[model samples]
Target: MDKTLHYLFDPLCGWCYGAAPAVSGLLESGGVSLELLPTGLFSGEGARPLDDAFAAYAWSNDQRIERLTGQRFSEKYRDRILGDRRQLFDSGPATVALTAVSLTEPARELEALEAIQHARYVDGNDVISLATLADLLRALGLDDAAAKLSHPDAELLGANQARMSRAQALMREFGARGVPTLIVGSGAKRQLLDHAAAYSNPRALISQLEAA
Candidate 1:
């Protein structure tokens, strides 16, 4: 049987960043098709101001994630991104940016995501801003994707919305409460893998997928 892994995540999610290595492992395994589905969890109505209390909470959670996954959540990120109160913690721009890449250069979507995540968590760049997101896309040599951000096509917007809806529906079906949820297999026979293993033991994750 053919297998596919649907990775549901939000760009601004620290746990999703933590899960990055395992996801990359799955992609590199060549065992199954990998589909990235953005959950839009921190976009639109889900966005909120970067206030003091939330920044502290986010940094603490990020530290724990770093310990678990060994993904860097730098002090620069802590002071600049989590400290900035002027901009909202919105994943809309980043999501749209990835969607643009998915639409224009399908093969490079994951690369775009990894770059965007690195820009936010490591370099302390504002992935939440359109201009910054455009620059990141350009840096990755995705000039077409960078251009699309300034004038998004209707198809791009629709695809993003549809993907988000499908991801959210799957989340509800699985009774999952947050991002970094993984569903292995295709169609009705699909199963939800243990999300925690994506951070703790990626080899086990590959084993599960190979079995699936």
Candidate 2:
């Protein structure tokens, strides 16, 4: 059997951020092949605006996710992003930038994810703009995102869309309800891990996947 795990997540998702440590741990264990599937839960063409009430709701929920997973959602984010007068929280450009990096420099996808996450959840940078994304890419030693944006060979945008399609297929196949989902197995046999407990315990998912 190929000891591989498919990690499906959205870059802007709070739950997915919370799941980072476990996922990172699993990745570091070297026992499984990691295939990241970005879901674009808050990215791409159809992202909704972040209204005041909606922002508050998201922050409260994010607090819970932080508590459970020990992931930090800094006060800087609240004060600088949520409380500030500026109102911009679109994730499309960030996702597209990530897609670009993933294609042109696949080895640094995890670093890109972390940089974006820190920018939003810690530094409170407006990650929706191409300029910000480009700055992050440059900071992380990736190519100049502006150049990549125009590069005809970059297949990340399309690949990101394809990943979303695969995520939908996985959701339907596993009867999942939302993002930050995991399907442990392949073909006709698979185990779904959508709840916090199962997600926190990789061994539980491994057992279920083996049984499946």
Model 2 residue 62 CA deviation (Å) reads 1.5
Q: Candidate 2 — what's its lDDT?
A: 0.71
How many clashes show up in model 2?
A: 0
The collision pairs in model 2 are none
Give all candidates' CA lDDT scores: 0.90, 0.71
Model 2 lDDT at residue 105 = 79
Estimate the TM-score of every prediction: 0.96, 0.84
Clashing pairs in 1: none
Tens-digit per-residue lDDT, 18-88, candidate 1: 99999999878885787889999999899999999999999999999999999999888988899899979
Worst 10 residues of 2 by lDDT: 145-154
Displacement of the residue 21 alpha carbon in candidate 1, Å: 0.4
